[model samples]
Target: MGKLLSVNLAVPEPNPAKSVGRTGINKRPVDGPVPVRAPGPKHGGLGSGLVGDQIFDVQSHGGDDQAVYAYAREDYDWWQAELGRELPGGLFGENITTVGVDVNGAAIGERWRIGPDVVLQATFGRIPCATFQYKMAEPHWVKRFTQAARPGTYLRIVEPGEIRAGDEVTVVQQPKVRVTIAEGFRALMLEPALLPRLLEVEELPEEDLAEIRKRIARSTRQRD
Candidate 1:
């Protein structure tokens, strides 16, 4: 069990890294309960699960599977020390900042009950992108982040409701799957050998599953 440290919403700004020319990665903390729900699919759907938040990159971000993004305060502390700078909540474009939570260690399909009503299920870890590198303004940030393997988890809204800062996060249900958010990220981005283990977690998005299957098939063909 952990506590919600803050509810951050994107403050759109010019994005030279993306062709869209604008990005919602500059998120700032807001003071109140925010409504949350599934934003449908990625492309042509509501971008963010939290009302007042924004997601400019529709093609690669935002959807039912990634409705809300959460990062742990512990991880932020580590990054701050590593980078020798201040790293705030939502700086990584996460909607929720959590304290005392192992976001990466959470199993896929694990359900978290935030505050009183909002139920969110862990889906996958966020993959670093160009926008993140631009936002961080760090050298080889993408590679550094990927190698650290503390990528935060993205969750789907299972039961829509309001969430606010200071809310307690309770793990209502944890699936019997071996694939955790960290393992999923490593499998998808770092180690292809781990892809076969992802199949045991049935809650993975279809696109991810398809990629896993394709990679497995390719590996098999090469072995033959």
Candidate 2:
């Protein structure tokens, strides 16, 4: 269990001059409770987010599996040290900032009951993208982020409600098969050998699971 330090919302502003793309990567912290719910099923899919939070890349960023992105304060502290600068709660574009809980270590399907009615289940890890690199203005940021292997976890909304800072984040459910966010990140990004392990967690993103299954099937065919 950990404390929810802040709730942030996506800032979708058009920067036509820059190549950052139409992105909602710039997120700012907000006060008090914010409504959380699934966006919608058709088209891109419903994002688990604050009422006003705008998701720019609906097709890739927001959906049932990646409804909410969470990052740990501890990891932020580490980033501050690495960057030699202050890294704020919403700096990584996470919807939820957590304290005392290992966001990366949270197992897939792990459910956190946030606030009174909001329940979010861990599903996948945040994959670095070009937009993020452009926003950070760090060369090789995408590669660096992937190599560092500390990607924060993406969670799906299980129950809708109002969530606020200071809410007690209680791990109400942990699935029998645990595939940690870190493990899933590595398997998806760096290590093909670990792909088979991802299947252990059924709640992972469907596309990712399908991709891994396809790779595993191919490998099996080659062996045959």
Candidate 3:
């Protein structure tokens, strides 16, 4: 069983250069259990963000597919070594920092039972944006992050409940075929060769689902 290292809350601040004047990508560690629930669909435009956390732009975030973001401490260590800087938990804008859990290895549609009642399903991988690039103060960060391909897992709340630091997280369910979060990122965002592999997973993100279908259709036409 993997452990929840820390529960981080975002603090929105002003930055004139960013896509949004207010930014919530700077997350800080917090104590105690925080409420976890679905924020509804993007079309509905309804969500509470995190309990004490916040988001500047809801259009690209805060929906069902990207409800809860999680990252492994091991990945943080990798960045720390590469960048030669201090990276605390939540530095990457992830709400939950995990230890001993392979966040990238988690399959799409996999369910994790957090605490007692809180359950979260892996939906997609985080795609870094210009807001994130500005936050990091690294101009090449978006390219670097995308090339690294260890994008954190974005989760949807399966069963609403409370989650706190030191809680045990166990994989309650995983898909049969290996459509891991990492593979999903590579296929959907970077490499077209991986497109066919992504189709094997049924519960993948809707955006990727539609794109793959289009790609298949285009290929079939060429074959004809």
TM-score against truth, every candidate: 0.97, 0.91, 0.91
Give per-residue CA lDDT, model 3, range 135-157, as digits (tens).
Answer: 78875999999999999999988
**Candidate 2 lDDT score at position 77:** 90
- lDDT for model 2, please: 0.83
Task: Please list the Cα RMSD from the true structure of every candidate, rounded to 1 decimal place.
Answer: 0.9, 2.2, 2.1
Per-residue lDDT of 1-224 in model 2, one digit per residue for the tens? 69899999877766452454577778899998898887664255655456877776656677777778899999989877877888888878898899988899999899999877999999888998767777777778889889988899988888999998899999999988888899888987898789888887868777778988998898789999
| Model 2 poorest ten-residue lDDT run | 40-49
- Candidate 1: Cα lDDT at 139: 100
Q: Candidate 3: which stretches are off by over 4 Å? A: 17-19, 214-224
Question: What lDDT score goes with residue 66 in model 1?
Answer: 90
Q: List the residue pairs that clash in candidate 3.
A: none
For model 1, the run of ten residues with the poorest summed lDDT: 171-180
Candidate 1 residue-wise lDDT at 117? 90
Clashing pairs in 1: none
- Global lDDT scores for all candidate models: 0.93, 0.83, 0.85
